[model samples]
Target: MKGTMVALGGGGFSMSEDGASALDDYILAMTKRPRPRICFIPTASGDADTYSERFEAAFRDRADTSVLSLFCHEPWGYSDPAMLLEQDVIYVGGGSTANLLAIWRLHGLPEMLEKALDSGTVLAGISAGMNCWFESSSTDSYGPLAPLDDGLGLIPGSACPHYLSEPRRRESYQHWVATGALADGFAVDDYAAVVWRDGAFVEAVAEQRDRPVFWVERTADGVVEREIPVRLLGQ
Candidate 1:
């Protein structure tokens, strides 16, 4: 069973004005099931209630939506890491990438996620969620935008979310890769998502036409940024 992943730079239910989006639908469609079971992990946002509520309201009608809160005062939804394997899609919410990783590690989630992936669960996330899947990423988790080398390493190279929406993300990421501080990788604009199947990049998709994805690489001349062609969703 090949693993699948959808890393969104930004703009999903969490960012959408209506708490619903074509990109969210695109993620559900990846399961190829009549009604996929999707679990939202909001650890990055410290399991924010509003975030989870938005997720439920957005996906409840279309998919079997559930929230797995690791920080709840009492047991909330599915607490066992093994339960994740039953999900058709595991969607992670955005917040502090650094905190998310630290908490997930303490709960032994990284290993379970790998097992779930190997068993064909589609792992998807936005912003911090997107950043956690790569070897390194440009993040604002610690304050100002900076490079973070510790990630789940599910995908090779590095990644930067909000490439276009966030100020300095593009220039800073490019500088890091160019200076050998980070590996060559991808950067995604708000509303854009990059797909990977079996740990290899498949394509890019976006909820809006103006949003794009890019491949940032280091060269002797410095850094090269190339805009990747994106398929506009809901067309």
Candidate 2:
């Protein structure tokens, strides 16, 4: 049992049509460590306090978890040694990418997360959270697609989540073709997530009932799209 890595969509909690058990199972599958102290980065949690509370309540009955929401208005404690070492999971919430990256680099979290992953720490997040894992992606909901000015690069290429619900899949694919900055990328729909291990996706968790996970990658000629049903143990 190796550690887990996850990327979430915007609808993670009550917003999720998928049952809570499915998400828990995904979390369980992601980590071999029990009662892991999870870090929830709600930099993208938005200004709605109620939504944030709802977001936190989503992870119910996990007594060992610790939530740390970074405030972009605050200064970075750049000198702290165990700044991010105490947690077992890093969860970023959905918000503006520009803001998330600005605060992340200011606080020097990119290096922190990379080192954490090296030690087998789990990473998870929705929307902006998921996008940070890729080299760069569509900054806007539309096709104003561009390489992330500041991406952690935890995962190479690009990731375009909310694939089917929003019109991001085709837009992302177009960007990949036009720029050639990103060769292959994932365009995951809502209530679905893909877990990448080493370099390739070895496991997938589909919280949705019918919606599939779209794995779109670019070839020398053009972009290719394939829809795969979500399962716990996927290859």
Candidate 3:
């Protein structure tokens, strides 16, 4: 079953109320099928118990959503599309960016992921999942898994999450521009999300403005910051 990919600005496993669209949209899209196979991928890290727990909590028991935990650490998360072809949604959990990318490549998951998504298999990622889809990643992901020199390019720009959740995140985001690392990026706060539709940044949804998301572009000199408005409630 082919579907769309929804890359969220925040991790939905824990704080799930806001990003329900990622799941709901997938569910609603399957019109002619009994239900699409829904799998939650946690392989970016090795914590199966916690990953499964969070996945179950976010969705509880649903006839349509089956709880499947995938760990990229096993060196086969990316290589096994046969295990994923029946899945309607591949929801990636957050973890170390470098480790996530490494495992995906080691298991040959990036190419598989791209094929799955291209065929209409819905791909939804949070945090590390979101980071892996873009053309590049932030240095922030370096702390946990080492910065990824390569990434799966479902998205054409860089992805930076936990925007206002951290102290001096503006400084951190700006540093990318100052140092000429990645030019265009989407900086999403913990409560926000940036949706890509037909290969473009289409929607930005948030819960507050204090922690808003950003869309950046690179120029010859430095990166230019553009504060994209999010349709957050009461903002």
Top TM-score: which candidate number? 1
Better model by TM-score, 1 or 3? Answer: 1
lDDT of 3 by residue, 73-188 (tens): 33223334456666667778777777777766766677777777767766777777778888776635556322344677777767777776766665666677557676467888
Candidate 2 per-residue C-alpha lDDT over 129-194 given as tens digits, one digit per residue, 9 for 90 to 100: 888888776566233645553566677667777777776556755666455766466777777787
Each model's TM-score?
0.97, 0.80, 0.78
Better of 1 and 2 by lDDT: 1
Worst 10 residues of 1 by lDDT: 72-81
Q: Candidate 2: lDDT over CA atoms? A: 0.64
Worst 10 residues of 2 by lDDT: 72-81
TM-score winner between candidates 1 and 2: 1
Total residue pair clashes for candidate 1: 0
Top-scoring candidate (lDDT): 1
Candidate 1 per-residue lDDT over residues 34-122, each given as its tens digit: 99999999999989887888898999998998788888623365488788989999999999999999999999999989999999899
- Stretches of model 1 off by over 4 angstroms after superposition: 73-78
Residues forming the 10-long window of minimal summed lDDT in candidate 3: 70-79
Query: Model 3: runs farther than 4 Å from truth?
Result: 1-3, 16-36, 66-80, 139-141, 144-147, 207-211, 233-235
Flag regions of model 2 displaced more than 4 Å: 1-3, 17-21, 46-48, 72-83, 141-149, 178-181, 232-235
Cα lDDT listed for each candidate: 0.92, 0.64, 0.63
